[model samples]
Each structure stands twice: as structure tokens, then as C-alpha cells.
Target: MKLQVAIDRVSLGYAVNLAEKLDSYVDIVEFGTSIVKDYGLIEIGHHRPAFKHAELLLDLKTFDEGPYEFEKGFDAQADILTVMGAAGADTLAGVHKVAQNRGGDLFIDLMETGTDKIAQISGFTDAIYGIHHSHDAVAGFDAVATVADFHEQFPNVKRISVAGGIDLPTAERLAKQGIAESVIVGSKIIKTADPVAAAKKFMEVIK
Candidate 1:
């Protein structure tokens, strides 16, 4: 299980600093949707903060105009980009093609999507299917249980990633469960007093 630390709701300068600090510690550093919406892709592309070790993921949460959004995200130098699972099949195909053509990865955000919808789009064998929980939801999430259920339902889907409010204990459990390819952590790692230490702790536990 890989550690993907998400940076969100912070200034671009601060996010860049955090990314630089965490580049070597984590496997992937994500610029959450807020970053893209607050500062457009053009700005991100121009800045192009260098990450020496970790890959960069832009959570575009693309709902439509897949080609345009994906092209811009890849141009901005994102190693991976996300599109909504609820998007139209054509839209999903568009972004998947862009990711393939650019030699990047596409993550389908499965927040609020049903099993039937997932089955319909499961043909994108190479894309990472992200079993995500909505950030705005009031309910809590059980990461392990969710991953188990998803795997049972869609056994053919080879790559799976999960994101919610994952803690160190949950991350460790996920690693042991051995289903999810990657686990995405946010405030638990980033909001702490010593983010590097927090991130390292997660890395240690997952290993």
C-alpha cells in the first residue's frame, strides 16, 4: 500500500512548500480540487513545482469536457489526474485516452457512484478506480470494510485506490488487508504539527 498525501485548503505557496518537504517521504503528493479551482491550471503549469521523488496528482474531479481538462492537467505536469465516476461514458473514455496518450495515469473518483454504474465503466482496465468518500458528507467511513466490499463486487478491476478520512491505524489495517493499491491521507498527515514525522509514521505503518 502506497501513501498518498493530499494538500488542500491551503495557499499555493504553502502547498508547494509542503510538497517539497514531503516529496521524498511519500509515494504521491496530491493537489486537491480546491487548489485547481482556486488557482487555475495555467498558473499551476507555469509554476510547475518540482517534486524530486513523489509523483504529482491533480484532483481535477473532472465532470465534463474531459479532453480539455485532461489535456490541461497533463500539460501542468501532473503524473496522475482524476475524473468523476458519475461522468458520462464518453467523457470517461475521453480522459482515459488522454491519460494513455500522454503516458500518465487516470483515476476515476467513485464518490457517490453505485455498483451498477461502476460495472458499466469497468472496461477501462488500466485506469485506477478510486473508491472515494465525499468530503462534505457528515457520516464517518470504514476504509477496510469499504475496500473489501468493493473488491468482492468488482473482482475484475485490477487497480483500486481509496480515500476518505484515513488514520494511521486504518492505513495499517488497509495494508494488512492487502486490497487497495494506494491509500490517500489528508488532514491526519498534513494538519499535524510535524507533517514530515506524521507522513513518515504512516509510511512505517503501511510498510
Candidate 2:
């Protein structure tokens, strides 16, 4: 399993610094949507860390103007860019092509999507399908059960990633379950006093 650490709602310098520190230890470093919104893609690109090991993911959460947004994200040096599953078929197809042409990866965030929609979009064999829970939602999430259900429903969809309130125990459970390719942890790591040490702890469990 890969550990993807999300850095959100912080200054650009701090986020970059954290990412640089965790670069060698983790599989992916994510610049959360808040980071992108706080500091535009131009500034982010100009100051992006030279990741020697991990891939960089920018949570664009793109809902429209698929090709344009994806192109810009790739230019900003994102190895993987996300689009909401709630987007239209045309929009999904557009971004898929853009990612293919640019040789980048597409992550479809199934945040509030229905079963039928997931079934429809499951044909995108190369894209990573993320089983996500809304951060704003008040309910709790069972990461292992959720991933198992998603896998049972869409067995053909490989490269699964899960996110939402994952901690050390949850991360270990998800790793042993072996359904998700990546487990995303945000505040559990970033909100800690020492993010690098926290990230190392998560990396140990996930490994």
C-alpha cells in the first residue's frame, strides 16, 4: 500500500517545506484543494519541491472545463489530477484524454456519485478511482468495509484510493485489507505538531 500525505490549509512555504521533508519516505505528496485555492497554480508551480521519490497529486476537484483545468494542472507539475465523478460524461472523457495525451494520471473522486454513475465511468481502465467521503459530512467512515464494498461492486476497477479521517490503526487495517492502492491522510498527519514524524509513523504502518 502507498501512503499519500495531504497538506492542506497552510501557507505555501510551509506546505512546500512539509512536502520536501516527506518526499523520500512516502509514495505520494498531495497539495490539497485548499492549497491550490489559497495559492494559485502559477505560484505553486514556481515553488514546487523537487520530489525525488514520491509523485505529486493536486486535488483540483475539477467540475468543469475539463481539458483546460487538467492542462493547467499538468503544467503546474502534477503527476496526478482529480476530477469529481459528479461531472458529466463528456467532461470525464475530456479530462481522460487530456491525461492520456499528457502522460499523466487521472483520479476520479467518487465523493457523492451514485452506483449507476460509477458503473458508467468504470470503463476508464487507466484512471485511479478514489472512494472518498466528504470531509464536511458528520458521519463516520469505515475505511476497510467501504473499500471492500467498492471492490465487490466494481471488481474490474483497479487502482483504488481511499480518503477521509484515516489514522494509524485505520491505515494499518487498510494496508492489510489490500484493496486500496493508496490511503490518503490529511489532518491526522498535517495537523500534528511534527508532520514529518507523523508521516513516518503512517509510513511504517502502511508499509
Candidate 3:
């Protein structure tokens, strides 16, 4: 499993620094939705902080105007961009096409999406299907169980990624579970006193 470190709820400068620091350790470095909204894609693109090792993922959470949003995101040098699973099929297809043609990847965030909608949108063979748990939700999340159930329900969706409150032990379990292609962790790594050390710990456990 690949490790994705999410940098969020911080200033743009800090996010870039963190991304640069964690580049060699993590497979993907994500600029969370807050970063995009705060700094805007135009600014981010103009001042693109290049990464030599890790791929960059932007959490756009696009609900409409899929093609346009995706175009701008790619222009901003993001290797992977996220679209909401709750979006209409046409919108999903539009963004998926943009990603494919631009040599970028799409991550479909399955947060608060129903089973029927998931079934309808499960055919994007190349896109990463994210088994997400909402940050604001009051309920607890069981990453392992949720992944297992999702696999049973959508056995055909091969490229799976998971996120929300992921820690070292959970990441290890996910790696052992062998279902998710990547695991996203935010506060566990980012909020630590030493984020690089925390990230290395996660990396060691997952490996």
C-alpha cells in the first residue's frame, strides 16, 4: 500500500514546506480542500511548488462543472484530483475524461454517497475509488471493517484508497488487509510535533 500524507488547515507556505519535507517519505502529498479554497488554484498554479518524488493530489470535491475544475486543477500541476461520488454520472464522466486525456488521475471520494450511486459510478476502471469517512461526522469509523464491506459490495472496483483519521496501526492493518491501493492520513502525521518522524513511523509500519 502507498502512503499519502495530507497537509491541511495550515497556511499555503506551511503546506508547501510540509509537502517538500515529506516528499521522499510518502508516495503522495495532498493539499486538502481547505488549502485550495483558501489559496485558490490560480495562485497555487502560478506559484507551483514542484515535488521531485511524491505525486500531488488536490481535494477539489468537485460537485459540478467537472471538466472546467479538472482542467484548472491539472493546470495547477496536480497529478491526482478528487471528484465527489455524489455527482451525476455525466459530471463524473466529464472529469474522468479530463484526467485521462491530461495524463492525470481521478480519485472518486465516496463520502456520504449511497450504495446505489456507488453501483452506478463503479465502472471508472482507471480512477481511484476512495473509501472515505467524513471528518465532521460524529460517528466512529472502522477502517478495516469498512474496507472489507466495500470490497464485498464492489468487488470489481480495483483501485481503492481510504482516508479519515488514519493512524500507524490502522495503516499497518490496511497494508496487511491488501485491499486499498493507498491510505490517506492527516492529523496523525501532520499534527504531530515532528511530522517527518510520525510519517516515517507510519511508513515503517505499513511496509
Off by over 4 Å in 2: none
Tell me how many clashing residue pairs each candidate has: 0, 0, 0
Determine which window of 10 residues in candidate 1 has minimal summed lDDT: 43-52
- Which tens-of-lDDT digit does each residue in 88-164 have in candidate 2? 99999999999999999999999999999999999999999999999999999998999999999999999999999
Please state the error at residue 178 of candidate 3 in Å. Answer: 0.6
Per-residue alpha-carbon lDDT of model 3 for 4-77, expressed as tens digits? 99989999999998888898889999999999999999988876667888999999999999999999999999
Model 3 lowest lDDT segment of ten: 43-52
Model 1 TM-score is 0.99
Alpha-carbon shift of residue 153 in model 1 (angstroms): 0.5
Predictions in order: lDDT: 0.94, 0.95, 0.95
Candidate 1: deviation at residue 133, Å?
A: 0.9
For each of the candidates, the C-alpha root-mean-square deviation to the true structure, in angstroms, is 0.7, 0.7, 0.6
lDDT of 1 by residue, 1-207 (tens): 899999999989899888989999999999999999999899888776788799999999999999999999999999999999999999999999999999999999999888899999988999899999899999999989999999999999889999999999999999999999999999999899999999999999998
**Backbone clash tally (model 3):** 0
